[model samples]
Target: MTDQRWAGVRQRVEAAGAGPGSGEVFGAWGHKWVVEEPLTRGELAELEAQTGVRLPEEYRAFLLHVGAGGAGPAYGLFPVRRVRGRWRWEGDGADLADLSRLDQPFPDQGPPRKLLDDLLAQRPEEEDFDEIEDFDDAIEAWDERWEAVMFTPERTSGAIVISHLGCAQREWLIISGSHRGTVWSDCRVDDADLVPLLDDDAVPVRFDRWYTDWLEGAERTALSAP
Candidate 1:
């Protein structure tokens, strides 16, 4: 079933690559529509064994059929690779994922809304300070508090950072718990909490839908380029 959904994905990606203005897509230069080689079943099994958690089925299928990672949404999907006999995803901010804790459940809620609001309210503004050095010092202190709330390892258990969207933004794939298989947008850089990526109908998008939507959109953009 998964194979059927991903059939010819490589061909489609190649076709998009050949389209006019394909390079205009954000992060196009990084992947150039090149899907990395798919992972073998044994390799996949080994990765799972090492991580101690089975990847979401759709993502597992993607790794098996479509490609381990490449030419994906944003600046391309971060590819997982074996290094020093251990499998790890390589990309900007990819290490943010605590692979050792993937078996844990992703928390249903992040820091409380009121807490986030308080933190934002406390953020320092350069214009508020007369001296630039004072502003920098104040902002540095505020940033430490902000990172403490936002960048904690527990904030994203059971998730993997999948794609980087530049400017400190990235996407996450949930691997365990109730939200398993869903793709989420991380906008913490913009002082927003991690939230589910919604579709046109405002539905939480799963891995297959997320990837396929991006592929189809890219194809349309390529074909329409004049």
Candidate 2:
């Protein structure tokens, strides 16, 4: 059944690659619509065993039937590779995922709304400071607090970063707990908390939908390129 669903995925990606302006898409230069080799069942098992968590089923099938990773949304999916006999994913900010804690439930909420708002409110404005050095010092202290709240490992437990959108933005695939199988947007770089990617109906987007939507859009962009 999974095989049936994933049928032609590689072909579709290839067809999209043939489009004249495909390279014009944001982050296309990184992957160039090139899908990597799929993983064997044994390799997949090894990865799961090493991580101590089963990957979302849809994404698992993708690694088996489509590609391990490549030519995805934004800059593209981070490719998982064997490094020095250990499996790990490679890409910008990929290290942000705490693989050792993949079994934990991804926190439903980040720091309290009031706390975030207070921190933002406290962000130093250069115009308010008589001395530039004072402004820099104030902003630096505020940033440390903000980072402590936003970038902690507990915030993203059970998630694997799947793609980097550049500028410190990325997407996550939830691998455990209630939200497992959903794709989430990471916009903490822009001072927003991680949120689930939503479909047109406002439902959370799953791994398969996220990839296929990007693939379809990429194909359209490619085919329409002049």
Candidate 3:
């Protein structure tokens, strides 16, 4: 999509908030921008080289054509260089995905889902034997597996950090895996976490579409206001 479409959204977003220094959040959904700028072709290339993975084509275009790091959901699109800081979790600070592993295929979700479901169903409500330690061991094992898949970088290989949603939430764009170009939300606090951004049709939403939707929604809200 043309960068011009984003310009109107930026205008509306700016009008909603006094300014970046005003500390006023914009949009009904609490979106705002920070660190507004555009990335050069050379910079984009260097980022790809450093990360060892190509960004999704549209996202790459956005960085080069649209502004680099502003006018997006949450605190806005993190400057590519600044992504490393927000890439990790708040509690343990584990990197979302290792730079070296960015090119690796993301693991299949089906296997892990089955493992978790089966283990959860088999969990004992009451220990028949006197071995309480056995129950503890089983619980720990399950937790370790769950954490690895839920919060670690390795589980989400081939995805790059997109934006921070605040309060321990984040957004990611798949770049190297089978479901590449799709946007996924990492809702760390939610029970069903790491879901794809799906539209009403249930098709996975890509970077451009997800962003456009946000902009359009903000515009509609702007127009409908009293």
Q: How many collisions per candidate?
A: 0, 0, 2
lDDT of 1 at 26: 69
Q: lDDT (CA) for every model shown?
A: 0.92, 0.91, 0.64
Q: Give the 10-residue window scoring lowest on summed lDDT in candidate 2.
A: 18-27
Error of 3 at 160 (Å): 1.5
Candidate 2: residue pairs that collide: none
* Cα misplacement distance, residue 191 of candidate 3 (Å): 3.3
Error of 2 at 150 (Å): 0.8
What's model 1's overall lDDT? 0.92
Ranking by lDDT: 1, 2, 3
Please, what are the lDDT tens digits per residue for candidate 2 over residues 75-168? Answer: 8999999999999989999999999999999888778899899989988899999999999999889889999999999999999999988889
Off by over 4 Å in 1: none
lDDT preference between candidates 1 and 2, better one: 1
Order of quality (TM-score): 2, 1, 3
Clashing pairs in 1: none
Q: What is the per-residue lDDT of model 1 for residues 153-188, given as tens digits with 9 covering 90 to 100?
A: 998999999999989999999998899999999989
